[model samples]
Target: MSISVVLLGEQESMVRQIESYQGELIVTRVCSEIAEAVAACLTAGAEVLLIADAQQVPLMEQVDELLSQGTAVVYLLDGSAAISPMPEVLQLPADIAMSDLEQRITATVRSLKLPEGSPERDDRETADLEPRDKGRIVSFWSAPGSPGRSTVALNFAVEAAAAGRSVVLLDADTYAASISIQLGLMDESASVAQICRIMDSGSADISRLNAACSLVQVGDTTIRVGTGIPRSSRWPEVRPSALRRATLAFKDHYDLVVLDVAPHIALDEQLSFDTQAPQRNAVTVEMLGCSDDIFMVVQSDSVGIPRALRAIDELEESHADLQPKIIFNRVSVSRSGRSPKRRLIEAWDRFGPMHDVVGFLPNDSAVCSASVLAGSPLLEIAPRSSLRMEIRSLAGIKSSNLPKKRVSRRFSKSA
Candidate 1:
C-alpha cells in the first residue's frame, strides 16, 4: 500500500526532491495554505506532510486532527531554508528510503502523545494542553509610543522571582527592541530570535532553551531572560509558529513567563494562497492569546488615558476574551491635576464598565534611569525609590480585590 503526502511552505526544490524520493507513492496535492493542506489530508487521506517552513509548525493542532486517521507530520528541516540546523543535527540525505522517513515521523507523532516521563516524549512538540503544572504567562502590552510597558514587564518579572516563583522574562517588543540595552546584555546574538529559529525547525529542547535564555541575579532570586528582536524591520524571524512553540516550551519550565510586547494589533490580510506570515502585529496578538494575565499599562494624563482607552476598545472588539487589568503609570507628583486618579476613574466609568485601577506608579525618571544605567532593576539598584515601592505593592495585590472585569463601552469612542 502506498502512503499519501501533501507538500507545503513554497519550497519548490525541496518539494520536488520529496516527490522524487517517494517514487510511486501518492502525492495528493501540493498545497501552500495550511488549511488547504488539512483539506487535502482529509479529502485525499494523505498520511504525511513535508512542511518546509518550521514557522508553520503551529498548524500542528489542525494537523493533529488528521493524525487520528493515521496522518503523521514533520518539518523537512532543510538547512537551505531560513532555519539552519545545529552542527549536531545530522541531515537526512536525498537518497534515504521513503519507508525510513515514514517510520521516523510515526515515532515523532507517537512520542508527542506519551507522558513526559517517557524519554522519547520529553521536549517533543505537544501543542494543545500541557499538564496543570504549566506556568502562567503574564504580558505587559500597551499602545505604541513608549508608555513604559517594558519597565513594567521587567519589574514584574523581578517581583515574581523575588516571591519565589521561577520566572522567565521575554523581550518580545519587535518594534523598538530595548530589553537588551536596558539590561546591559552586551551579547547581541543571544536574543529570542535564536530560540524562534530553533523552534521553527520543530526541535526545541532544554539545551536550546538554556542557550537562548540569560540569567540575571537579584540577591538570591534569579530571572531567566530572552532578548527581543534587535531590529524592527526583521519581523519575519519571529513568525507565529516559532512564537507559539517557544512560549509553550517556556511555560513548561517556568512558574511565570513575562513578555514585553509590541503595541500594534494588525493582522496581514492579503490575496495569496502562500501568505503564511500573519501581519507584524500577529506576533503581539499571538503573545496575548497565550498569556494568562495581561497588564495594559497607561500613562496618567489626558492624552495617555484617552489613547489607552481607545486601545482597549480596539483589542476588545477583536479579542472577546481580553480581560486585561489597566495599570496607570507615572502618576503626577506636582499636584497640578488635583485628584487625577479620581478624574481618570470617573472618565473610564462614563465610557463603560472597566477593570479597576490595578495599581499606580510614580513618575520617578531619575530612579528608573539609574537602574537602567546600572543594568539592574530598581529592586537592586534603587530599592528605596518610590517607583519600586509602588511596583511592589502592585505585585502583591490580592486577587479578590483585582477589580471585577466588566464589559467595555457598547461602542468604540472616537480617537
Candidate 2:
C-alpha cells in the first residue's frame, strides 16, 4: 500500500521538499487558517499530517484535534528555533529539519500498517471459537528512581485477586528482574527465560507457557507471576509484540493481567541483538500510548515533586490526551510543617493542573519492614497499616469507577 499524507503550512519550499519523497505522496497546501487545513487533511484521507514551521500557534490546536481524529502528526521545527516554554501543548514529535520530518512521517506510517493476516483481525474472526472472558489489563509504572511501582503493583494485584478476581501479575520490567527475587520464586525450575526461548522459536503454546508459570496462592487469591530477564540488554529479545501476545493469552485464562513495565520508553532496534538500545526520553509517552489510564505516583518531598513536574511535562508532550491521576506516596502531615492538603495544593499549583490528586499513602515504617521481611505484598503483610488502607482506597476507587455494563459485555463477548 502507498503512503498518503497532508502537509499544512504557508511555506511553499517546505511543501515542495515533502513532494520530493519517493513513495506515493498526496500533498494539500493550507495557508493561514488552521481549521480549514485540518479539515482538508481529514477529507483527503491523509494518515499522516506534517506541519511546517510557517504554521501559527492556533495550528497546534488543529493538530491536537487531528490527533483526536486518529491522524499521526509530525511537527517540523527550525534547528535554531528557540523552544517555547509550553512545548507540551504541541503533542506531536518535533522534527528539526526536512530529513528528520521525512523519517518520522515514514516511521509513523510503517508502524500503523496492518501486516498480512493481522493477528488482531484474525483473533476477531475466531472470536466465537476462543474464550472471550479474558479480563482487564491493569499496568503499573513509576518514574525512574523508586517511586514504589513494583510494591504498589504487586499489592494491587494481590488485593484484586483477594477480591475473587483471577489475576496474573506480569513482571514486564526487563531491566530489573526483581519480582522473582522479591517473592522468593527465583529458582532454576521456573522462569520467563524458558518462555522467551519457546516464543523465540515461534512454538510457544498455551500449555507450554502455563507449564512455565509459577502459581503462588496467598489466602484466597491465586496469582500467576511472569518473571523478567536478568539483564536490561536482553529486553530487545522480549519484543513488545511478544509481550502483547502473551498478555492476550493470559487474558484468556485470567480475570485480570497486572503488568509491571520498566520505567522507560519503548524503542525499536534494527538488529535484535543490540546491547545498548537508544533510549528515548519519552518513556511517559510510550507508557501512556499503551495504557488505558495512568497513575502517576510521587513521593511528597522537594526532590520528588520536581521530578514529577518534569515527568508530567514529558508525558504531556507525548500524550496530551491522557489525564494522569496523581498518587502521593509517603505523604506525611508533620513533615510538611503545615497541612498536607495545603502542601499538595501548592505542588499542583506550581507544576500543572492536568493532574488529579486521587489519594495519599502515609509514610509507615512498619509497612516497609513487613514487605521486606515477608517478601509479600504490604496488603498481605500489614493489612491494618495506614499505607495499606490508602492503597486499598485507591484500588476501590478504580474498581467503583469501572463501568459494570462494559465489563460484563466484554466478558460475555469473550465467553
Candidate 3:
C-alpha cells in the first residue's frame, strides 16, 4: 500500500479524487476542522497529514510536530509563491489531477528519509489523479479589444449571488487584467497567478482557494472575486491543467464559477520540438474547454458587429465543442435606423455561419461610467439603465433557461 493519508479541512473534490483513485493510499482519517487535522496525526497512524488550505499556514508548528513524529506533510496551496517553512516536506497543488498529484506526493515522500521513530510508510505501486464535478463553469470572453467581458461577467456573478446562489467572479484575462481596477480593490493580493501556484502546490483546498479570493460587494450581493494577472507580462505562469483544476475547485466552493478569460489563442513555446509546450493564450481556450456555458461578448456598432460575427464564425470552426452564445453589447436602437435586433438577426442568419445570437445589450455610456466611478455593479449605480436592464435580463434568462449542476454526493463522506 501507499502512504496512509490523514486529510484535514474542506476540499471534498480533492478528497474524493484521492480515495477513489486506485492506489495504495488508505485514508485513515479525514477531518473537517483544522484542530481535528492537527490532532488526528496521533491516533490515526497516518504517514501523510494533508492539509487542504494555505490559509492554515499558521499551523506550520503543528505540521512540524507531525513531521517530527514522521508524518509526511503535504500542503495544497492557492497560487501564492510563499515558500514552505519546512522545505523537505511535500507541497502539492490542490486542483491538480488526483492521479498526477497522488503519484507526485507518494513518490516524493518515498524519496524523503523516514524521520527517527516514524512508521507510516508503504512501498506499493502508484499513479496519478483525475477530476470530478462542483458546478457549471460559465466563462466570458471577447475579441481583440474591450467588449465589456469583465463587466458582463461581474454583472452576471453579482446577479447570480443576489439571487441567493454562491458566485465566484474570476478574472483570468491575460490581456489588460482590469477586475481590481473595475471594482476599486486596492489590494493586489490574490490573482490567477497565485491561484495557479496553489493548484500547482498540491495542497490547495477550499480554505486556501478562499484565502486567494477576496470577497467584494456588488450592489447588495456579496461574492468571491478572484483577481487576474497583475501584469500581462506574467501570463507565462498560468498553465491549462492548473487552471482546469482551480476552476473545478472553485466550482465546489461556489454555486457558480464565472471566469473572465483572455482574448487570444497564441502559443508560448512553439519551437521546443516537444510540441506539447504551454501557450500564453491557452488561458482563453482552456477556460472555454471547461465552460458549461460561454458568452462571447461583442460590441454592436457596424465595425464591431462584423468583426464579432467573423470571430464567432471562427470560434465555431475552431472550437466545435463550444456553443458560445454571442452577446452583442452596446447597440443603439435609434442609430440603427430600423429595428436593430431584426436587422442584426436577418444579417446573422444570412451572412454568419453559426448565426446563434443570444440578444442585444443597449449602449449607455453615462450609466457605464457611473458604475465604474462608484466601483459598483450597474444594479447599484443605475438599475433602470438600458445596459443594466439587458444584463439583468440576461441573468434572468440564465437562471430560467440554463441548466445548473447539482452538487455531487461524492465529497459528502470525505468533506
Report lDDT (CA) for all predictions: 0.69, 0.60, 0.70
Q: Between 1 and 2, whose TM-score is larger? A: 1
* Lowest lDDT block of 10, candidate 3: 406-415
Per-prediction TM-score to the true structure, in the order listed = 0.68, 0.60, 0.63
By lDDT, rank the candidates, best first: 3, 1, 2
- Models, CA RMSD each: 11.8, 16.1, 14.3
Best by TM-score: 1
lDDT of 3 by residue, 29-111 (tens): 87877778767886665778787866655343355456556677787877774753343456676677777777777765664
For lDDT, the strongest prediction is: 3
**Residues 1-415, candidate 1, lDDT per residue (tens digit)?**
5556687677677656557866544566787778887777877867676675655553433543564465666556545545433211223433455677656555554564575345555445432234567888998988766778898889888877877888888888878878767777766674577887777555657577767777776655677788887866676677754676688778878888899899888674443437343467878988888788898898877677778877888898888677788888888745217776776677668873467668777888888888788777766777666787778787773323221222111111111
TM accuracy, model 3: 0.63
Off by over 4 Å in 3: 1-133, 272-277, 397-415
Ten residues in sequence with the least summed lDDT for candidate 2:
406-415
Cα displacement (angstroms), candidate 2, residue 118, comes to 16
